[model samples]
Target: MIVAEKKPIEEIIDQVKDFQKLLIAGCNECVTVCEAGGKKEVGILASALRMYFMNEGKKVEIDEVTLERQCDHEYLEEIRDRIDKYDAVLSLACGVGVQFMAEKYFSTPVFPGVNTCFMGAAEERGVWSERCQACGQCILGETAGICPISRCAKRLLNGPCGGSTKGKCEISKDLDCAWQLILDRLKELDRLDDYEKIMPIKDWSTERAGGPRKVVREDVRL
Candidate 1:
């Protein structure tokens, strides 16, 4: 899932302070699971903004709403009827969601309330770790299940960098070496021979280097 963290309240306050009416929008998808931008979080933010404005001797009208997903046009259209009611919208969804909303409501000022982190998994309660960088070229088949592109500090493709010490990364002892993890997994699977095979240089054009990407599945098209 896409992981995100809430932006500082001070930063958010600075963005919407001049507006008399504001809308705090949340998402019920990835942000909800990450405990960053959800229905509960929207209410909390709305309350905080209201209290701040009240304390400043200003009257601010704030509304809270959570969409099933801000990334989807169907969910975003739900607010079309009343979008003009607000001076600005504070979106608590990922960057993609915020951008989508901005594009959908071009006249409205859309502000991001959370910083999109990365595509990752929940390691434990309240702890999320990066798992994939969406590099477009997947090599997990030969590297066991561990991803060298995302897990490696240097994004090494073939083997561990010389900087690695023991099983830990050279950048930080707290970090595990991606190559080490890959080797261990391959050994367990009795596919260590795969490691000896050299991987060709990755074609990065398939990634962001080629600019924004889109998929066209003719079978799924309406």
Candidate 2:
């Protein structure tokens, strides 16, 4: 899942201080799972903003709404009729969703409400751990499903890096050594011998930084 955390309220307030009418938009997708920009979060933020303004003797028009997804044009179109009513939009979505809203409403100011964290899994009720860097190349099959790119500080294709101490990473005592994780997983599956394989350098051309990559099936194209 695309794990994210809410941005600081103070930071968000700075972006739309001049706008009396603000729309706090949330998404029902990734950010929702992380509890960063779900419908409930939208209400909480909206109320807080109202209280903050009221305390300062300012009358601000703050409305909160949640869309099925801020990234989809079809879903965002539903807000077109209501969007013009606000001076600025505070997107409580991931960076992608915020950008999509900005692209669709170029005349209105758009602000981000969350910081996109990492590609991770939900470990528990309130815990999420980084698992993949989405580096445009995948090496999980060869490494017993443990990702070196995201977990290892060095991003070493072959790791333990001569820097790991005991079973912890050298960069931080709190982190488990990524190579140690790979070895343990490989040992459990009796695939320890596979660790000798040298991973190829990642081809970054398919990544977002390379400019949007797309796939089209001519057979399906009408």
Candidate 3:
């Protein structure tokens, strides 16, 4: 899932301080699972903002709302009727969600409440680790399910570079060498022979090199 972290409260306040009426919008998806932005977090942020305004001797109207998803057009429409009631909206969703919301409500200002990190997985409670870069080209089929592109410090296609020592990456002892993991997994699957076949240079054109991407599935289109 897309991982995100909360931005500093001071920064958030800075963005919406000029507006007397503010809406704190949260998401019920990835940010919810990560504890950064959700219904619970929306309430917490609302309370904190109210306290700040109260302490400043200023009266502010802040509303809290958590949508099923800010990225989807259907969910975003839920707020259309009352959206203009607020001076601005503080979106506590992923960057994608924030942009989507802003696009839908082009006239209203939408500020990000969280810093989008990356596509990652939760290793444990409160601990999320980066797993994929979404390079557009998936090479996991040949790498024993270990992604060298995302985990490797060097992003080497065929590697366990000389920098690796004792199955650890040169960048950090705690970091396992991605290629080493692949080699071990391959050995277990008795597919070590596949390692001898060198992969061709990757076609990066399919990735960000081509700029923003879009998927068009004719069969799925209504």
What TM-score against the true fold does each predicted structure earn?
0.98, 0.92, 0.97
* Candidates, ranked, lDDT: 1, 3, 2
User: Whole-model lDDT, candidate 2?
Assistant: 0.89
> Residue by residue across 1-222, what tens digits does model 1's lDDT show?
999999999999998899988999999999999999999999999999989999999999999999999999999999999999999999999999999999999999999999999999999899999999998888889889999999999999999999989999999998999999999999999999999999998999989999999989999999
TM-score, predicted candidate 1 vs. hidden true structure: 0.98
Looking at candidate 2, the ten consecutive residues that score lowest on lDDT are: 198-207
- Tens digits of per-residue lDDT for model 3 on 1-222? 999999999999999889999999999999999999999999999999999999998899999999999999999999999999999999999999999999999999999999999999999999998999989989999999999889999989976899999999999999999999999999999999999999889888778898988889999999
lDDT string for model 2 (1-222, tens) is: 788899999998788778899999999998899999999999999998899889988889999899999889999998999989999999998888999999999999999999998889888999899998777678788888888888898888876888888889988898999999999999999998888877777776766778876679999998
Best candidate (score: lDDT): 1
In angstroms, give how far residue 48 of model 1 lies from its true place. 1.1
User: How much lDDT does each candidate structure score?
Assistant: 0.96, 0.89, 0.94
Off by over 4 Å in 1: none
For model 3, what is the C-alpha lDDT against the true structure? Answer: 0.94
